[model samples]
Each structure stands twice: as structure tokens, then as C-alpha cells.
Target: MRDYDEITAFLGEWGPYQKSVFFFLSLSVFPNGFCGLSIVFVGDIPEHRCFIPGNLNLSEAWMNRTIPLEQDKDKLQYSKCRRYRLDVIKNLSEIFPDPDSVNISEVGQEPCLDGWVYSKEQYISTIVSEWDLVCNNEWKGPFAMSIFFIGVLTGSFISGQLSDRFGRKLILYGTMGVQSVFSVLQIFSPNWELFCLLNFFVGLGQISNYVAAFVLGSELLGKSTRAIFGILGVCISFAIGYMTLPFVAYFIRNWRILLFTLSLSGLIYIPMWWFVPESPRWLLVKGKAKEAEAIFRHIAKKNGVTPPEVFFTDLELEDLKAKSKQSSTIIDLFKSPNIRAITIVNFLLWMIITSIYNGLSLNTSNLHGDDYLNCFFAGAIEVPAYIASWIFIQRFPRRLSLTGILFLGGVVFFFIQLIPSNLSIIATVLVMIGKFAVSCALAMVYVYTVELYPTIVRNMGIGTSTMASRLGSIISPYIFYLGIYYEFLPFILIGCVLILAASLVLLLPETINIPLPEMIDQMQKFKFISRRDHMNLDPLYTHAATEEDNTVTQKTEEI
Candidate 1:
């Protein structure tokens, strides 16, 4: 058993190749958020109407009052609308001076409705009722977000049961296959209701990338690499937004075409699937002793090492004693000690995170788009956050560093409220700071949750947590819908929710530099540490690389 544990420890010690695969895979899942933002890219900014019945030249006031809104109907009815219309024509370039302005902004939104503009939709009634195909906004707005996250929540919860019954790798492949099909379908949806429905189904399939990818990676790796891989996986997954967002913002004229084209990138994994090993731990639990042994032997042989036959025999001896008590079902999770608490906290953290992440990304409308230039600049800021978090994560303990990141996100979001768009430089800086902190918070929460759970209920815990995360996701669109009505509403709500999430994190124990928490009780054994020494992993982490992981690295190195 000791040797088996020793050999099992370093199964993926070579490098970050598997981490790389996971990172790339994460992109297929998260780019939907980026796409959500870009959905409003070519649409018009809406103008508010006061509906007063006096002598004010509504058109003149509209043109010279602020920025010219893409659509203005409520102001058109004013009795003195003539003089107001003339001033707008004089400065047409700045405020719809020419006839072609509407044609130019009509990229994805077709037909060019004569009196409508695009903006956020924080109201549920408006999102469900008003902004369908009759409007250029389409059904793919907040409702699409709700549908996608619903799929994520359900997939996250169910993937655990599937893995528990079958195995990890199989479930992973199955989920990805389904997600690819649905993602492609989402792009071509023609109507508002149909598009919303397709987005819901697509979200369902895409979320599988999250649940299965993380568990599959964690099962194959040693503890030392797990946290790093987990965090990096999330960052790289989202970074696709930086590259893809710019491309979509620039070249992809139609939203559906961009989605369909991006869907093809997922196929890159099909060939790579030849190498990902199934979870030996899961096999062991199923009493597939010979199968587990063969895997172990193969790993040992590949590492220039050998597993003694005794290790296999000992691991196979089912602890009949432990087995006699009760068969461990997924349901045992709800009733377990301390695990229930962890599950609740984990779920809430994901919810708050997904809410803010998806919400803010879609809020790109509020950001500048004089050209696609802003998209590139906004996306570029993510890299620095990744590097900064990379340096601090393994060094700083999860509690303080993670809380700081989340709190920082909330602080930046809060400041965004104070700084108006007119103060362009300050607003831009604040947005960058907010994005950086939120990204770090997102990476830490996902990695930390994975580390806190034990192997027995690992998948279940993650799935349940993601379910809560999905709930947060569902609410994001509604919040965004409200922001459309009241410009700062969503930002204010997201900032406050994020602050609550940051506070909630402090209640959970830290898991850096500590041994992998096996049973729930071991979680109570946490100790705080200084920032500098966080990356020093335990000896168990570098045992020996498994054949599956080692095989891929050797081939890559040779090539």
C-alpha cells in the first residue's frame, strides 16, 4: 500500500502538458461569456425619452444633449421637433449626420429596425417580452445566459453521478461530444425563441467541459501540480476570449457564423483523446482490481520503475470492514460531516463568481468600441493578472490572497460607479483593475474548492458547487437586464454579491502547503503560512510520472 501510494504520487510530474490540454479545453467552455459580450458589438446604444409635451425641440435636444442614440422615437413626437432635427443634421457625423450610419452599425442585427437601439436588459419582463426578433437585440440576450447556465448547473450536478457510475474519461468524452453538437447548433438558430432555446441546450453541453475536465485532470495528477493546473486551466480557458473576441469583433460579420466557426476548435481534442487515462482511483472503488493493477504496472514501467506485485494485491483487498457499514452512494454527500458545509460554501462561491464574470463580460457594451481596438486592449489585461496570480497563488495562502483578489474585484467594481465615462482614462484603469482582480478570484475559488474535497466525494462536491455557480449564472442575465433599464444597477448588484462571496471565503479554511485533505476531518488541520514559501509542495507530489502522462511528454520533447 505504501509503495502503491508512492508510485501513485508523481503520475504527472513531467510538465504541464495535461494542464495545457485542460487549459485549451477550458476555452471551448468559457468563450460563450465572451460571445455574450460581443453579441451587442454592432448594435446601437439606446436613448432615453422624457415624453414632455412642451416647446423643447426634442431632436435638437437629443442631438446636442448627450451622445446621439441609435434610435429615438419618444422624442420624435414633440410639437417643436423641427429645429431640433436641423442641428442634428448639421453635426450628422457626431450624431447620425448621414443616411448610412444605420447600415454601417447593422452587422449581426439585420433589417435595421427604424426606431430601436440596443442596451442591457436587467428586467426579466423586458428580456422575456420586448427584445425578440421584432428588435435587433434578438432572444439571445439575458435569456440565452439563463439557458446556458441552467445547462451548466444541471451538467455540473449530473456529471458526478455519471462518472461515479461509469468512469471519468468516458464521461468526459461523452460530455464533450454532446457539447460540440449543441454549440454548433446554437450559432444557426434563426428566431429569438429558437435561438434562446438553442442557447439553453448549448449551455447544457458546454458546462460538461467544466465538471469533467477538472475531475479528469485532478485524478491523473499529483497533489503538487493539481492547484497550479486547475488555476491555469481556468485562465487559459477564458484567455481565448481575448483572441477570439478581437477576431469576432473584427472579421466575423455575423454572430452565428462566428459561433459555428469557433465550435470547430473543439475537434482538436479528438486525436488527443488517445492518451488521457481513466481514473485508477475510480476503478479501484468499483472492485476492478485487475484493471487498476494493469494501469499501475503500465505507469511504473513507463517511469523506468516497477511496481512490486504486492502493491497490486494489497490495494485489491477491499476493506470489507469499511464496506460492511453502507454502500457509498452520491446521496451520502448531503448527510456527511463537515462535507455539507464545504459543499454549500463551494457552491455559493461559484455562483457569485460566474455571476460577476458573465455579467461583467457582457457589460462590454458600457466599455468603448470606437473600433475593435478596445476589445484587444481589454483582453490583453488578462495576461498580467494570470502572471500576477501565478506568482502569488502557490506562494500566498488561499485565504488571504483569494480574499484580497475577490475584495479587490468588488472594490474596482465599486469605483466604476464613481468614475463617469467622461473621465475615460480613470474609468479604463478602473475597469482593468476590476477585470484583473475578478480573474484572480475566479482561478483561486475553482482551484481551492477542488483541493478541499476528498477523493470519495470529489466529483460530487465539485458538481454541487458548480450547480450553485450555475444558479449565479442564471441570475446574471436578469441582473444585466436590469442594468439596461438603470445603467448602474447590474454593476452595483454584481459588486455587492462579489463582496459577499469574498467574505464567505474567509469562513472556509486554507489549503495551501497542507497535505491533500482526504477525509472531511483532515480539513480542520489547516495552518496559515507566509507568502514566500507557498510553492514548496510535499514530497508525495513528485513521486513518478504515470505512463499515460509521461508517454505524451516524452513524445513531445522528442519532437
Candidate 2:
């Protein structure tokens, strides 16, 4: 029985067919990048103060007195949510020779009954300004972001099943349309409730489209190119989209216009339906041998190669059919002791990585700099991180690299707290460095987790782990809320969680250059040394009896 890789060998790896598929599939990831994080700009809270009614009737001194003064850090500013009683202030101004002589501190204050006056220096309009999502209603901002992640969680859980039942291409295009339409609808939302409701569906479609395209690209591309496209291509595309976001947000400024622009960008992908092909592997698994053969022939012709009349034999088809029938469930992930340990560790690592990644991203406004520059810096940092990840995954042990980067990120976060409040620039730089480390770990874990699970349950394992990550994202927005109690509490919590996750990573086996397992029994028998022990071993005996025994056992189980 021949494998798909053997068949793909004849079609060529870096030819026009593979390149086109790679380009289109990766293009889909761009819009997902910004749409997911657009809330950072759309919900931004600008400098504001209470609007004093009938202020024109008063003199300059009395007008200033209408709003009480408060100390923020070293600077004094007008109170944001409250103003003194206008009638009392007017009466005092008339009775007293000088308005400044009256003690403003003794005056009573009330909530801004006439609405708030927002600063237009940065944003012309935002959801925060549009709906007055400030002061007592500040919690709504993070809650809207949380609602979107809840949709992402829903989408991640359902996308795989839908792709399996339907096809990758169908689900990919369908979800893309769903994401696009609902995102546009967000601009028309009259209230915050409706906006959040639309955002929920947008999240559902966003992640579904992303995962479908990712899986489709992996299946369609040749083995030699698969790892590159899977690991680096999609990620770099996402970074480009993310970097583009700040520039767009900076220029547009209005929340509705920004969303409309981002949502409309999805239309560019509509033409992809004509260009992108369904996964040939999925077709073959579903017994559509002729369809799969047609796609292979199309790929060959595009690459200027000719295929024999009998490209695939009946015996090979039967073998593939039998292989596809051997399915696994979520329960299989924890049915065995070794596999269970791997599952639990990967789940927790994903949670921590996701929390730190998003927690730092959503908290960009907290940094002392332009929100656009900070966000751009955050996205730009990931580009090099992805490149570094590609090199590290090939050279270093996956387990140690994952643990080391995560630990480094945590240590950076710990030091961020020690920076003086006045040195916000230094703090911002430290946060970006920490973001870089976390980004590297995030890229490594995706490839590492796939390599860790057996082929039988690879999709299930990744799906389950992705769900865990979404759960972490849901909590991420709330993590910043901790600042209400203690200014540095969010960083301290993330740092502690990341460090604890890094320690757990040490328990998992490394997968660098190791043959991927095909079954539970194979995974159970696999053995690995700690990176320190492996480094100490003699190169001549690196593949000695103990290692050979495990390799032989894996092969025997496959047979």
C-alpha cells in the first residue's frame, strides 16, 4: 500500500500548484489577525471630563470651578465622572467677591447629568465614547471582548466536526462569509448589546475560517513544503495583517468606519473559492478516488509533469479506506497513562501561552506610548519570533526550547513590576521583550503539540488543546481588570502562571527529529532523555539499544 507522501512526490513540492494553494490559504489568515484584536482600538477610552451645563453664563474663573480638580499621578486634572452643583457654584460666584476664594472641596459633587465631554485628540469616536462605556460602565468594554472569545470558543469546537462532515473548502468559504457579513453588521449595531451579539457570531466565523484554511493548506501542500507553510506561512501572514491594523485604525479613528473597513476586507477573499481547491486527502478518505485523482492530475499538469493513466491503484485506495476507518475519540486522549500525561501538560501549556499572548496584546493601551505604535510594535515583534521559532524547532530540543522561552517570558514579566512608575518607556520595552518570548513559545507549541499526539488522534488532540487556549483568552480581558485593585497585579499573575506552565513542560518528551507515532501503543512505548542527559550522551551511541528498542516497537505496532 502506497502512502499519500509517496504519491505527492511525483507532483513536485514547490511548483505552481502548491504555491498557489499556499498563497490563497495564507491570504485568508490576514483579516483574522486584525478582526480579532480590533476591539483594542474600537473600545479605547479617551481623556474625558463631565460636561457642565450653562457654563457660558459664568466667568472664566467660575467656569473652571464648575469641574472639580483631582490629582492623577503628578498632574492635576478635572474630575472625570463628577461636577460640582452648578446652581450652588453660580450663587457662590455672585455672593463672593472672588470665585477662587470659595473652597471647591467643600462643594457637593454629582454624576455628569448632562453627559461627558470626550477628548478628540486621539480618536474622533469610539464605542467607549459613543455609548459612554466609562466610569460605572467601564466593565462593559472588557465584557464585549469576552463575548467575542466566547464565540471563538464555540467556533473552535464546531469547525472541526463541520469540516469533517462537510469539506474543508466548503466550511472555509462558508465561515469566511459568515465572519464578513456579521462584522459589517457590527457597524449598524444601535446599542452595545447588539454590537456584542454580532461580535459573538463574528468570533465564531473568524476562528472557523482560520482553522479550516490551516488544515486545508496542510493537506494540499506536499510533505517537504507542509511544515514550512503550516508553521511559518500562516503565522507571518497573520502578523502582516496585525501590523496593518494600527495604521488603519490610526487613519480612520472612528470605531464604525474602522470595523466597516476591516469587515469589507473579507470580500477580497471571496474570489478565492474559484482558486482554492478542496483537500485531496479529505476527498480520498471519503472514497472519492476519482475526484482525488483528478486533483492530483491537475497539480501535475500545473507543474509541467505527466502522470501515468493509472495514477492510483485499487489496492492503494482500499488501504487508504481501511486506514481512514480507524477513528479515535476525545476519550482516547486520556485512556492511557502516558498519553493522558501528554494531553494534560499540552492543555495547560496552551492555556498559559494563550493567556499571556492575549493578555499582553489587549493591555497595549496601558503602556505609556501611542496605542498605535505600541500595537504595531507588538505585531511587528512576532515576525522575527516566527523566524526564530522555525530555526529553534529544527535545531534545539522541542521540550526544552518551549520551556526555556516560556520561562524567559515569565522572568521578563516579573522584572516589569520592578521598573519605577516614572520609567514607563522602560516598562513598555520590557513588555515587548516579554511578548517576543511568549510569541516564540506560542509558535513552537503548535508544531510541538501536533508532533506529540499520535496520527490517529492528532486532530482531536489539537482541537481539544485549542479549546483550552480559547478558555484562556476568555479570561484574558478580565485579567487586566485586576489593575483596578492593584496596578501590577495582572503582570504578576501572568508571570506566575507562565512560570508554573514552563515547569510542567519539562515533564513532556521531546519530539525533535523523532518519528511521529501512529497509535496509542506506539506513544506508550516511546522513550526520551532530558535535554541535559541527551547532550551528555556519546554521539556514536546516541541511537543505541534503548532508543532502537522504542523505534522498533513503533514499527512493530504499525505493522
Candidate 1: TM-score? Answer: 0.71
User: Per-residue CA lDDT of candidate 2, range 1-559, in tens?
Assistant: 7778887788878998888889989889999887878998999899998987675477777887788888775588888988998778878888875786888789898888888999999999999999999888989999998999999999999999999989999999999999999999999999999999999999999999999999999999887877789768898889889999999998999999999999888987988988888888999889898998888888889899987789678888788788777677898777655677688888898988997798888988778988999999999999999998999998998888888998998898889889987899999998999999999999999999888887778899999999999999898888988987877888898889989988988878767666776655445222342222222132211233478656655554443
* Model 1, span 1-559: residue lDDT tens: 3433464754456444444445544544454435434444423233222222224334553434322234332223312111223333345435554445544322222232223332333211222233433233433555666776787777777777787788877877787777677767765555567766766666666666556666666666666666565666556555656546766546664455666666675676586566566777677667776787777677665665646755544533556223433334555455443555556677788878877776665566556444355556566666677767777776888878888888888877777768765676777677667877877777777668777776545656666776777788787766666754666666677679778988878877666655554443334322232222222133311233468544533442332
Q: Cα RMSD (Å) per model?
A: 11.6, 5.3
TM-score for candidate 2, residues paired by index: 0.92
Name the regions of candidate 2 deviating beyond 4 angstroms: 524-549, 552-559
Whole-structure CA lDDT of model 2: 0.85
Total residue pair clashes for candidate 2 = 0
TM per prediction: 0.71, 0.92
Please give the lDDT score at residue 99 for candidate 2. 80
